[model samples]
Structure formats: structure tokens, C-alpha cells
Target: MDLRQLRYFVAVAETRHFGRAAERLHMAQSPLSQAIRQLESQVGATLFERTTRRVDLTPAGTSLLEDARRILAGVEDARRRVEQVAAGTEGVVTVGATDLAAYRLLPRLA
Candidate 1:
């Protein structure tokens, strides 16, 4: 439902084991499992088929996996763009100069 839940879902989905996903996420397994439960509730679908030793995505989860990946990727891209702009490493700049200044100074500056 939210970004945190999506992240948690992605982690669990990718690893296919709650314990391993928790380790990969650097969190305790309990909370990770809880978050996934919450995500399943919010989404109104069962996302995984769990056995004693392994986890597998259900059809709904398979559908969600693609969108979750895309959404996370877009969020990451947006975050990077915002950070870059804030750090003055990206975005547009406008300069005003006379023709002679543009011809000479801009060339030298570039």
C-alpha cells in the first residue's frame, strides 16, 4: 500500500524466504512478516504461497511484482533527480549576456 510496504514486499518476493529477506533487509523477521501480512490485507490478495522451507509468489503476487518493481524504480529515479538538483548537479541554468559576452565568455567558460 505504501512505499515501505512495497519495499518489504519486494524484499520478500525476491528472496522467497522470510528469514533471508529479513536478513537482506537488515531487520528482524517478525516485523518483516507482519509488514507482508499488512500488505496482503491492504491489497486484498494472497501474495505468496508459503511452505516450511520456501516461499513462492501466487498469481496475484506475480502481477504485483512487475508493478512494484516499476514503481520502486520510478521513486528511486525521482529521489536521485531531486537530490541532484538540490546538490546543484542537475537541472537547467539560464544566463544572460550580450552578444559579445556570449560569443567570448561563454565559449571560454564552456
Candidate 2:
């Protein structure tokens, strides 16, 4: 549903335990569980099968995991692009040369 929810879902799905995921996420277990519930509700599917002893991804969760990964990767790439542009390094480079320098020195610089 949200980035935080997707992060929590991915962590839980990978770890297969709410407590472990919560620990890895540095959050309390209850909120992590709540976020997964919210995510499943928003997606209109159960994302995991839970029992006393184990947790497993539902088929929908397995499929959605790849989508979530792509979504996150895109978001991060966009952020990085913005940061690079802000830092004046978004594939823009400056080269200085003089007419005489080009004849004798530019080839060596290259």
C-alpha cells in the first residue's frame, strides 16, 4: 500500500517470521504485523500463510514480490537521478581545451 508497507512485506516474506522481520526492520512486532495486514487489505489478497510455527508466502505474495521489487528499484533510481542532478553530475561533464593545447595535449588527456 505504501513504501513502508512494501518494505515490511518484503522483509517478512524473506524472513518468514514476524518477530525476525520486526527485528530486522528495527520496529516493534505489532506495527509490522499491522502494516502487513494493511498491505494485504489494500492489495485485495492474502500475502502470507501463518501458523504457530511457520509463515509462508501465498501465491499472490510470491507474484507480487517481484512487482514490489521493481517498484522499489524504480523509486530508488529516481531518487538517485534527482540527487545526481542536484549535485550537478547527471551525466554532464566539463572539458577545457585551448586551440594550441588541442594540437599537442588533448590527445594525451583523452
Candidate 3:
């Protein structure tokens, strides 16, 4: 559904352990469980098959994992592109100056 839910789902799916995912996400386990439940309800499918000893992905979960990864990657790419545009760069930059000027300005630029 929403990006947050997809993110949480991806975290859980990757780790295959709710507790560890919660720790990695820096949140409590209970809320993470709830969010996953809500996500399942929204999608009308069970994403994981949980046992006392292990967690496994259902067929739907596997499919969602691929899609979620693509969506997240696209989101990150978009953000970086926006940053580059706002920075007044379009994939390239060139600076020309005398050797002495370049050496002198490098430190200040840094």
C-alpha cells in the first residue's frame, strides 16, 4: 500500500524474523507485527508463513519482494536525480583555471 508499509514488509521479509527486523528498524516488535498484519489485510494475502522456529515467505511474498525492491530503488533514484538537478548539475561538471589557482582554491572548496 503506502511506502512505509512496503518498507516494513521488505524489512521483515528480508530478515525473516520480526524481532530482528524491529531491532534493525529501531522500533518495537509489536508495532511491526501490527503493520505487517495491516499490510496483509490491505493486500488480501498472507505474505509470510511463520513457525515457532523459522519464518518463510509465501508465494505472494516472493512476488511482492521483487516489486518492492524495484519500487524502493526507483524512489531512491528519483531522489538522487532531484538532488542533482537542484544542485545545478546534469550529470557532468567542468572547472577550468590555472594550475596555481586550482591548487590554491582546492582547499577552500573542500
Candidate 4:
């Protein structure tokens, strides 16, 4: 549903364990589990097949995995581009000329 829930889903999908995903996310196990449950409810599908021994993805989960990854990657790319443009603005430019032609060009630019 939301980006936070999507991130939680991806973490769980990658780790295949709720506890491990929680640890990696620096959150408690219960909250992580609750979030996953909430996400499942919102999506109206069980994304993972969980058991005492292991966790695996359903067909729907597999489909969502690719989409979630692309969405997250795109958001990160957009953030980096914005940061780069902002970083570029914190600067100055200078030009030097040793001949009359270059000096004339500079004046024309002004």
C-alpha cells in the first residue's frame, strides 16, 4: 500500500524470515510481523508462504517483488538526481581570456 509497507515486504521477501528482517530493519519482531500482516491485508493476498521451517513466496509475491524493486530503485534514482542538481548549484564559474576575441565573446555573453 505505502512505501514503508513495500519496504517491509521486500525485506521479508529477501530474508525469508520475519525475525531476521526485523533485526536488519532495527525494529522489533512483533511490529515487523504486524506490518507484514497489514500489508497482506491491504493487498488482499498472501505474499509469502510461511511455516515453522521456512518462508517462501507465492506467485503473487513473485510478481510484486519485481514491481517493488523497480519502484524503490526509481525513487532512489530520482532522489540522487535531485541531490546532484542541488549540489551543482553551490558553486561559481570563471573564465579567462588573453586575447581581444575572447574578451569580446565574454562581453557578448554578459
Please state every model's RMSD to the true fold in angstroms. 1.9, 3.1, 7.0, 4.9
Best-fitting candidate, scored by lDDT:
1
Score residue 41 of candidate 3 by CA lDDT: 97
What tens digits encode model 1's per-residue C-alpha lDDT throughout 1-110?
99999999999999999999999999999999999999999999999999998899999999999999999999999999999999999999998999999999999998
Compose the digit string of candidate 2's lDDT tens values, residues 64-107.
88989889899999999999999888877878888999899988
Query: Which residue pairs does candidate 3 place in steric collision?
Result: none
Candidate 4 lDDT tens digits, 41-103: 988999999899888999999999999999999999888888877889534567777688577
Judging by TM-score, tell me the better candidate of 1 and 4.
Answer: 1
Model 3, stretches more than 4 Å misplaced? 91-110
Query: TM-score for every candidate vs. truth?
Result: 0.87, 0.81, 0.80, 0.80
Give the candidate order by descending TM-score.
1, 2, 4, 3
Which candidate wins on TM-score? 1
Error of 4 at 84 (Å): 0.7
TM-score of 3: 0.80
The Cα RMSD in angstroms, rounded to one decimal, for candidate 2 relative to the true structure is 3.1
Clashes of 4: 0
Go through the candidates in order and give each one's C-alpha lDDT.
0.95, 0.92, 0.92, 0.89
70 in model 3: Cα distance from truth in Å? 0.4
Please say which candidate is ahead in TM-score: 1 or 3: 1
**2 or 4, which is superior by lDDT?**
2
